[model samples]
Target: MFSPDALIASAKRTISLEQDAISSLLARIDDSFVRACELILNCKGRVVVVGMGKSGHIAHKIAATLASTGTPAFFVHPAEASHGDMGMITADDVVLALSNSGTTNEIVTLLPLIKRLGLTLISMTGNPDSTLANAAQVNLDTQVSKEACPLNLAPTSSTTVTLVLGDALAIALLEARGFTPEDFAFSHPGGALGRRLLLKVEHVMHSGDELPAVTRDASLRATLLEMTQKGLGMTLILAPDRTLAGIFTDGDLRRALDKGIDVREANIAELMTHGGKTARPEMLAAEALKIMEDHKISSLPVVNENNQAIGALNMHDLLRAGVM
Candidate 1:
């Protein structure tokens, strides 16, 4: 009953059919697409996407994509709109309704109310001649010759085409609005991209008494104590003026041991890297990570313009802060 070859053959056929359906959508991206974009761009209120069943799932995704990419949007189930939920929509909103048949009764019921409010309607339907398309100000034809389903009934290729078209619309508006990565990060502050863009070195670096430091005249044993107390595996060697004179790391301790130098007696200045690579207080934690990576070092001193050591951080600090 478990025939691998038959399963592979069926999967390939389904993929090929879906590929063909998606390719056909390219020719349909014409003036109607531009009008749809223009209508949404000019709208004063948010985009309200509505659909039913499988189409409702795709409508929800499209709304999320539009909202995160600079356009304000949300999804409202068509069936719910018939109830008191219709009040959620306003005269300023633009309605984007999706239905492959363009005749889903729940959606059709809202058309009258949408028209009464004089709201702009955009439709995504397989049948452009259907009632829903005829009522729309602009119709995005998502017609597919056949479904990936062998029975040609389940929505497969058509939903993919609609989703891709929605992504195209969102990205076009994002570009038109000159949306930046910072703008996107603001929308996704809890995500990794937000951590990379919004997290500053000062936000994660150790400062004040937490900063591990010792004078250049200190012994290697004293530096080791400072490193252990700070738990950064390194310490800053400062000059008399509290300016950064050098940095000493675990690697330097290893090299000192190789040279048969006694940690209790050897001057830290002899083993510390003089005026080593540094970061700024306002620098991005991601940028600080880059600097550590480029120099192949694990620790960095946060210095001011006058070369005064203000703070310090290590790879673990970045890792703890989610910058790594």
Candidate 2:
């Protein structure tokens, strides 16, 4: 077989160089990183990210991660800042300026005004001596010895180090702010995580007259009729005070038939299972699903504190709600 050798060898070299770049990035996370974290954590306004070209793309991504993980941020292109986008940067906001060489003119072009406004600046730079780095309140060193590009010319390793440094800052601030999954859900209400976490039992559970309910003194035939009519696969046995007394399900019917009990004559109170698994109106639908799973049942009656049936839900309701 003829070997197309140079391209394959070059590919391997790119992978190795990038791996080295990432490894070098780890060693660079030191006290300066702590200063960056402190500045972001203390900021009362949004984190405004600014960069040019390839760094601009990375800056946009960093801004999105910061916003999603509970730190409010937005991306402003450095070139656009000179054309009046500079108004987006408020004095209370922290400006994250990114430049691998730390002297990108597009970013530096906005410096005089950004400084005049007295806004806090945080810079990611390979060159500590560069103007942008020297002007910032915090400097994150994203220096890499070489790039994955074989020519060592492109922004490969530098971009990776910058991205890692951005992630490090985001996660540190996220932990310090005590950002929870529920808080993230509130910000992303249209996604699956929001649907799963924020959608409550009351929003999905069957309420009012749709609930399959019967009194304990009712006949087994009447309970079975109620179950068949309501199609919940079960029926709630309620006390006189409207609290749950017991439950009658298809399982109880099968057992009663196995024991030769006459459904027409049997009292539902004697046939029903007393004090079975129940759900509350305020309980999470996901939690109710877990209880049903643990008990090997398919339905649960939601009840009040006095044990009266307030509502009922089944596995089908959960499946329809997309909680399953």
Candidate 3:
């Protein structure tokens, strides 16, 4: 019995309402917000986030964002805290409590004990005048004009605003700490982002015997054999003293065939590209990929400080390492 048009209309209205709620939050980033950030920034211990029901879900996400961005944080359900989880909070910790109505019984019940422990209390609530806000040292107002739900009972727009506010707080703290991409990579070492930011050419490139190389005076036939044996689509051309002279790739082979050059007799130095694009062992794998893409090449030779080819890598290596 549901109409498609009605469903689309309801979805659009919900999005629009949530957008307005977030927009309203921009003006609410007052001194209280700054105070809350300062408390968390100065805390010697971790941030302890507590909420009930829908707020608890948002609290969990906020805690994750904070932890990943250089802040130590964890979420504790308000009801669970009442049972036995209250032991998790220490005097040095900062408590970040969330309640839309600011009257969540479970959270409210913990306020007395929180005060006794001398922990810094920061509250995010939709009701500015609620008991939770009054009991906190600093209060963040996440008030929304109305719920996105037509019934006005569901925590729709209010939850969206709260989540956005939490993100804003996390980003502010991250910037305050001067968090860098490498710092982020350390926290997410198992993810694709970690590979892109942390994995270096030395970590994935073919080195030692696996690196394909041929002297500049070597015949094209021998260079092709090295390429085939290495399967890197390219071979590094080294001078007599073992320094990088040039590079020969499949593209050069194709051009040689087009010109009808004699592969058996032609020297690799004559056809090789001089001082071709190269990567450093310490360079990020993603940077090597970018260089390959910019030059429209498939392989890169990793060079040392002395300009000697120490390793080799190709697009396939990047793909296999999850750096693509």
User: With candidate 3 superimposed using the best TM-score fit, by how many Å does residue 234's alpha carbon deviate from the native?
Assistant: 1.3
Worst 10 residues of 1 by lDDT: 262-271
Whole-model Cα lDDT of every candidate shown, in order = 0.94, 0.87, 0.94
Candidate RMSDs in Å, in order, are 1.8, 2.3, 1.7
Residue pairs clashing, model 1: none
Could you give candidate 1's per-residue lDDT for residues 136-166 as a string of tens digits? 9999999999999878899998898889999
- For model 3, residues 174-287, the per-residue Cα lDDT tens digits are 999999999999999999999899999999999999999999889999999999998889999998777899999899999999999998899898999999889999999999
Q: By summed lDDT, which 10 consecutive residues of candidate 2 come out lowest?
A: 198-207
List the pairs of residues colliding in candidate 3. Answer: none
All candidates' TM-scores? 0.94, 0.91, 0.94
Runs in model 3 with CA error above 4 Å?
none
Pairs that clash in candidate 2: 242-308, 243-307, 243-308, 244-307, 244-308
lDDT of 2 at 169: 86
